[model samples]
Target chain A: MAKVLLKGNEAVVRAAIEAGCKYFFGYPITPQNEIPEYFSKELPKIGGAFVQGESEVASINMLYGAAAAGARAMTSSSSPGIALMQEGIGYISKAELPAVIVNMMRGGPGLGGIQPSQSDYHMCVKGGANGDYHNIVLAPGNVQELVDMVQEAFDIADQYGMLVIVLADGLIGQMMEPVELRKPKARPIEPKTWALTGPNGGKPHRIYNLKLQAPDLEQDNIDLFKKYEVIEKNETRYEDYMMDDAEFAFASYGTASRVVRTAVDKLRAEGYKIGLIRPQTLWPFPYEAFKRPNIKKYLDVELSMGQMIDDVAIACGDKNMIEFFGHTGGVLITVDEVCDFAKKIMGGAK
Target chain B: MSRIDRIFCAGFGGQGVMSMGQLLAYAAMLEELEVTWCPSYGPEMRGGEANCSVTISDERIGSPLINNDATVGVFMNGAAYNKFKNKVQPGGKIFMNSDLIEDSNPRTDVTYYKIPVNSIATRLGKIQLANMVMLGALNDQAHLVNQDMLLEAFKKVFGAAKEKYIPINKEALAEGAKAAAEMFK
Candidate 1:
């Protein structure tokens, strides 16, 4: 398809439709509100369903219900709204249901503000709900990447029968850019043999998140962890920009990476061997990408007060020096300021 | 060096700040240049103080934000002018709506064009058309995109239902550009 100017929020819905997402259940929130709004308009035209649930909690449970019925289901929201969906998300993987959730992150611990933020890194990647489970997290840096990732999120969800979350900030959600809505790589469509298409011929399948017995739940957790290991091995993705001989790397993702890329260009022009290590997947964390021995240090940049910095520090380990520069409560950092910060880091680099 | 034009526009909610940024960004995209438009939305927009940043680059745009590196800025109110006056690059240009902003003692390094967008749009009998006038004036001074490409954007935005208003908007744009031609150069 030809390129069309689209907001990051609207692009998510378009990509979901292309990926054969048949049912969307989401409550409204700033920045990401466009996702459900667009879905509500477009999905019905394609003989699909778009339901605005009573609340974010209700919406996610609706998505869970749809996914259990063997339908490609999705729900999208911003910070507080997404936080409300945590229990439902935690419930999905144990039930072995496939669902896609988009959290266009906004500032806060609790309805902070309608500004872009990456503070929910721990919440999304660490499985904020009560469990030993992790959702497959896909972090897209731009609108095109966002489009591709949303489609990929669906495939990854179905392929492994796991929940996949596309983690983008409100900036990425509200920003407008031209994007070609195309599924570049078509993953093999997983057959819905496990779906409960009503007991007409085969044995009935009982699926629920409530694993009451201790050993049964423990075994399920072990199996789920094993599946996560397989996913980590296969689906871990990161992009290294100008990192072949980088002395220092800007470890970031999503909108923060976009600003850092410009800093890389500027700092490179100034003879600073700075590069970018943008993790496309927040989970699986792409620890292998940090094996660049040439990089003397890693500077983790983000819109939050350094949540992802911990992840980068974990990836880099004790050998390399890891520094953090971030803004809290939706205060944005600019390319110029990043360049200034990079210069200071370059001056101090070994 | 790849050209990157970072344009910022600010005003009250209905002052056409968003429209100016959108039109310019759309026109640049039509010209096959990389473009990104980001609005400071939520309370920053709908709560009255609206502002938007548009970046047009020959290369892939890294950040949709301009921050303190705007090559050009358009301000429709005194608050916008005050907030963004020091934000532009040293050699950048600012187009202020003189009719709305009274105290614009612009910085010496960056150039300033005080265009009377409100007065011009008032003359056109469409006060809301200040955004078009401001956009026309800015484009004329900067030559961010050709006149033809911008007209196409106006057409696309106005759509078929409002086809009749295109000519009026085009005239307003031309008038603003003509005003710019007189002031600049």
Candidate 2:
């Protein structure tokens, strides 16, 4: 396969095309504008549909419309834009429509700076639109994974009938990397037999997230939880680097994980035994993957801070070995600083 | 196993920092090395300074970011130099465009090559290709990848351009390599 130098946003667009995504609906926003620009140019060449919606709300709802018609549909936006799309995303989740939404996160509370940030962890995992719906979130550290996960997000969404999110930041969205396009899968397009796709010689199918009856709503919630349980059991993914017989473990994800990996390598070279646990599946949390008997003795949770650390705390549980280190509000933590912390911990442990 | 070498090229926006990094990355892929070229984006790439990190590895690269010190720093302007000079490793090489930067001295510990890259590109009739020229010089001096590999990268990158521009770029590359070779001696 020929390697092409592509920005992360462009890579995602290319990957979506390769994955047989037929429709893209998005509005322009900083840090993720390349995605729509790419689709606008390339989608037509591939005979796909690209639409620039009036707003992020409209774009996500349009995606919901496409997904209801059983097309592989996607949309991308930054933090504020994503906030606007939350209502539609909730509807998609509750309606169980398989769609991919990419949040190339920028710093936020509102119209925050366009720098890369991991501040949207809670909003992505917990704040879909309303009440108890869960969206499977995949965090990619670099460009290749950005492409790979978009494909994976589609597959997972199709398999489980859920909204799949590729949670990335402006940094990952903007960075360029050589990516080999995966061969197109020849799977038949599976239409949702239960969706409201114009009734064909039968009773019309109605699609809505609102269940008026209390008992029915409770049962629906229970069924959703059961599906989430299956995902938690089977789909948690995390990578352990230099973890064998290590006294300290660094936990992080996305762009921060790259920094941790570098720190781990440098510390290993310096004879300081520090391992790294990078959670690939943010929603499933990879709790089981990190719970090995040996690994439990030495795990230090690191994050962009105050956000993902909550997951680490949950995973670590009564096993109080987990500690925290972080740099918040878009402050990047250097490898040297991480290495120093690792050395201090290793020295004390020994 | 495939080996990937990740290189970061940084400097001012118009200095062709991103293009230079991209050329090498595309060239490395042509040589059958797994490659990735990522540019700094957002407001940074607009009118301000720019930089790109290109990873050409034989294996699948785990990350595209350059967290540690860069193996090479090509600073085409004062902002580039001030921003990235300290980011070069102890024994790493720094290529500063002496034509634009009058005082091109970095720390005494590392090897610094002062090339009048802009002047050379001006002589070649197109000052925009200074980034390509610096790339040629770097390949000549460091020999980190290979001359043939870089030329192959140039071909792969510029294949879509008009047929006539290919030879001009190749010549520009050769001129860059010659200039760099002269400085090393």
Q: Who wins the TM-score comparison?
A: 1
Docking class of 2: medium
lDDT of 1 by residue, B18-57 (tens): 8788888888888999999999888543538888999999
Q: Supply DockQ values for each candidate.
A: 0.77, 0.51
**Per-residue lDDT for B1-185 in model 2, tens only?**
34434466777777778778877776676666766666766555455878887766776554566655667778888777777777777787888888877654549877888888889889989988788788888877766567666666666666756446766677777888898778756
- RMSD to the true structure for each prediction, in A, is 1.8, 2.7
After superposition of all CA atoms, the RMSD between model 2 and the true structure is 2.7
- What fraction of the correct interface contacts does each predicted structure contain? 0.74, 0.51
Candidate 2 off by > 4 Å = A183-191, A296-303, A348-350, B1-8, B34-36, B44-47, B55-68, B104-106
lDDT tens digits, residue span A36-144, model 2:
9989998888788899999998999999999988888899999899999999989998998899999998777688777788878899977657889889999988777
Give the Cα-based TM-score of candidate 1 against the true structure.
Answer: 0.96
Model 1's CAPRI class is medium
DockQ of 1: 0.77
Most accurate candidate by DockQ: 1
lDDT of 1 at A297: 79
